[model samples]
Target: MRHYQPGSVVQMVRDAIVGRCRHIAPRTFLMVAAAVTGLVTGVTAYLLKKMIVFVSKSVIGIIHPDGFSLWFVLLALCGIILSAVFQRYVVRDYVEDGCSRIIMRDLRERKYYLKKRDMIAAFMASSITLGFGGSAGAEGPIAFTGGAIGSNLGRFAGARKSDVRLLIGIGAGAGIAGIFQAPLGGMLFTLEIMAMPMTTWAVMALALGCVTSAMTSASLAGFRIDFPVGSFSDFSLGLLPAVLLLGLFCGLYSVYYNTTGNIAAGLIARVRTWWGRAVVSGLMLGVCVSMVPMLYGEGYSAMGRLMSGDYGVLGVNSVFSDMATPPSLILLAGAVLVLKGIAKASATRGGGVGGDFAPTLFAGCVAGFFFAQVSDALFGVRLPPVEMAFVGMAGVMAGAVRAPLMAAFLVAEMSGTYRIFFPIIIVAAVSYATARIAERVIRNVKSCAERAR
Candidate 1:
């Protein structure tokens, strides 16, 4: 009913549709803030890695009476205890959880721009988790540090909520990318795992921010920081069926992962007393640390060894049939998986403020290791366990996030050559579907049981 201005109609329409694009006078300030957030996450991740390696080396050196103090073991023990203590008494940092907390905080709460003071506390919490030989990964802390910087910065800078969320994703992606030197994976992960089902425009914004942050982090760290990955063999056409089979196996395992994780979270939530939970978790972790040697730290070194070749035979006691038997390492891998679950749940319940994604990834990798071994035994043929291991990684991750494409892309971008990309895709898709079906079935049973109770 309103008459449009003679020539102002177009301008009015544009204003209504596009909204006001506030630039704040287009100052370099916002750009700098974003870059700074990325840098902080990157530098923190890099530094964290170095810190763990340095302290870990010292710990190993101190193992002797005179010259060798075996301080690494003591440090490990202390670090484990301290982590338990921190979770219970310190930061108390569990917010939204499932995939990663950083994602949850940024998207759900609009807590953009991480504050330095807040980040340092988170850094300490994660450092203790790694220092004490706890079976965890660095991704959670990296994301936490990144998210804090982004959330705090945005809050201080007065950015729009959308912009702030993007910044947090960027920082988180950068943090993870820098550590694994997997820029694309980090970017995709932030988009796929961190953000909720996004609109096209929002997806573009998130992906761009995450990717840029990852690239910046990689530039600061290195073009590609090489770490030990699993041993991948030459691809053979004969392995296609096995690859598909392996993918399905991983999917089933992923259901186990998510289900157990939910149960663990529920268990922690049931407890009311923080210190009581912390002390109990600490004692449990201490006993686990004492009992299992490889359950400590990031488990990278162990993962590399397990993936480099295969240990044949069935069960934990089997000798390598050749060098590709994965079955024999099941017990060892299973131990790490169990302790990681305990450490993660204990930390959340007990008081250590952190995310569970890292622990989940670590457990997934170990589960993948076992899956590859079992597949080799069942078929009586040695497929490329290395590639299978990587497939396992994506599969487990897919279960958590329910994003098969992203999971596949994350792994391929991180590790696969051009040649193996398609195979990785195949594996990830199968794994995702498998996990989804199994999850539905398990949830149905669980619901029924609860109703009966």
Candidate 2:
């Protein structure tokens, strides 16, 4: 037998694979690539989640929930500063707002290719940010990472730009589906949030990718992401009024969140130095988290507790724990709903890397609970808090993200039932309409003022 160099053997194997690929039909190749992208994206999502969890447990897990500690301020500060430094020095690129960046690139540049570094940059930066207790979500960075994976894979295969775009969507959809274990939600996100034009082939590819990713994620994590739910209360016309009011409440809250989030981000952006921004972000987060400990991290744990009827989780680590009475808890929940947007913006803009997805849902959950309490106290309307919270999650998310169907479907998947599907749709629709109307009013008012000047 002829001895071959190790390098020669690798090259021969690569040549064989490439030679075989050349014979495969383009559509078949694309479909195979989509499946591979989904599988890889699922792994990426799992790793990102594990990194965040490990970091969080190492840092914040030491703190006692029965009492208060300002150490979280330091942890939050360090996390943001580290993420900013990593982005500026290590990555040497802007990797935040992955979704927006992807959309802008596709629309403006017609370039479906992303740098290879992107596959890991957002993952590392966001891991550090969330691990250190930054109030942001992992979904955005994973989506960005996934898109890069798909884009690069297509480009490597010498695919056309249109084909590359489809790959990008597959990667993104797979990422969302993997993280949330909601395949339909993931596909909808690409179509609705990414604004990808849907074709039959595109839909099929997305479905394959999303389902694969979600299955991978579920297998790796050993469980699906879920929220505790109350017994399915009978839906009656009598409950319609409360459902409508909840939708309106969610929409108005979404507007407030968007407006304040912008203002907060703008304020932080004024800081010239990375350290200055970090300090400002740290101080802002420190104050908010100090007041409401649930403001720390993505607040998913708190959301779980809220859904499970454990209201004490809201005030447990808070300095305001002394006032954990029902009335005080209601007030605290309202405060969380108000401050979450600011906290999220501060973390993301202040050199930390994360997405708004979790923060939006967390705020929605709190908003629903707060509304339920206030309604019960004032009007004696005995709405199920758990069910209302579930609906509110979809409503505010729908309004804030401007993707009603995705939001509704995501909630359906999380709840593991379609019993509440119709209510979610009703709330999502009203919330979307209300947000649109409010946003238009705000815009026209601003324009009028500008014209007057």
Candidate 3:
């Protein structure tokens, strides 16, 4: 082959100059720009949450409070109708609200706009899911929307590729922090889950975004427990076995949540019609929801039950194990988990858009309750289910998202207790490692299939 032309060197130099101009835009400017992203996200999340809560509490209360009685039949019908319409018509083509789809469509530049829509939509969707009773969290929706906006802005603003990517990451971190009011959790969430490889730059930006958003949210919300999980003491030599066992058990429960949730999503996906899926899911969930109101919404009421230390049927770990009873409460919890998984997974899979963060906590609480009983009978250890419930919540959440640090930190922040940090770390590590190994197995299988094809 002939030698390359001398102008090749000139072309390379031209590209370098353009890149320098893009990255050299002052650091101060970038920080301020990114901080604006946090500011807007914080305001939006706060306002939207209030509106959703108001709708759920005030508007819905006035409409229907007596569970599908003849007095509330029309309201239930309207709820079903709205659910069907939105699933069928509006979010029909939007399967998964997945980042992969957004990227494939070249939405890097359109992220800012997407964030706005996502935030508002998450607010409305969460309200509907909770208000009339679908059972989910606003965190996922908020995160998705925030990430979309930040990512799109980068591309649209003509920033360097690295800058765009970093900004997108920061946006996701900001959303997590702002909504949850958990700074360390938000930073770790980005590093372990959102960012691809966890680089130094990503850490810096993520930390900045999280801190900024959390502070903004705190200032506005007056710094209370945004969402309380659980906590424990006794990280000393005496409690090693219990702590380690907690981790192992939590990992197993996380696996259950992930596998079962996926199964529900698969079922919904196969239905071929969004309305059919929605109606079926809604009805299935509705029937059981009448039994254990804890199985509905974000399950905050269930959490309250746990905090109150009541071991009765309505209590946190109070699974109806009687084998008698009309609609067996034990079977009811299992069925509710399956159905709730569908409501959450299907929405994400079908394009209604959101995340699976809340499901793990629900599963964890249930497992903690179950394990509490097991420990008392089998192991003869009186592990307080309330505290262990938080551990389970963190562990499952860590495993599902592959964010061990965030999971551990989330529990600590919720309880304002650092005494159990060491144990939390251990449990988190186990949950994350186990889930990662499992994920790799699936990934490798997929790769092998693709190569064979």
Candidate 1 has a TM-score of: 0.76
Prediction-by-prediction clash tally: 33, 0, 10
Candidate lDDT (C-alpha), each: 0.59, 0.84, 0.60
Give a tens-digit lDDT track for model 1, residues 170-216. Answer: 66776666566566667666766675554565445444445555566
Q: For candidate 2, what is the lDDT? A: 0.84
- Evaluate residue 294 in candidate 3 and report its C-alpha lDDT on the 0 to 100 scale: 52
Which stretches of candidate 2 lie above 4 Å from their native place? 1-14, 61-66, 98-100
For candidate 1, the per-residue lDDT at 365 reads 62
TM-score of each: 0.76, 0.95, 0.76
Error of 3 at 35 (Å): 1.2
lDDT of 1: 0.59
lDDT of 3 by residue, 1-453 (tens): 334477777546545554654666445445654776677666655664665566557645674444323322233234444645654465542323543335324433533344334434444555555455455666675665566657655555556566666676677777777877777877766666654454665566667777778788777877767444444456566666776777777776566667766786677667787567665555545554544445545665565566556434342222343333323433544454445555555434433334566666666666656566567756678776666666667777787767788888876775667876786788788878877777788789999999999
For candidate 1, the C-alpha RMSD (Å) to the true structure equals 9.1
User: What TM-score number comes out for model 3?
Assistant: 0.76
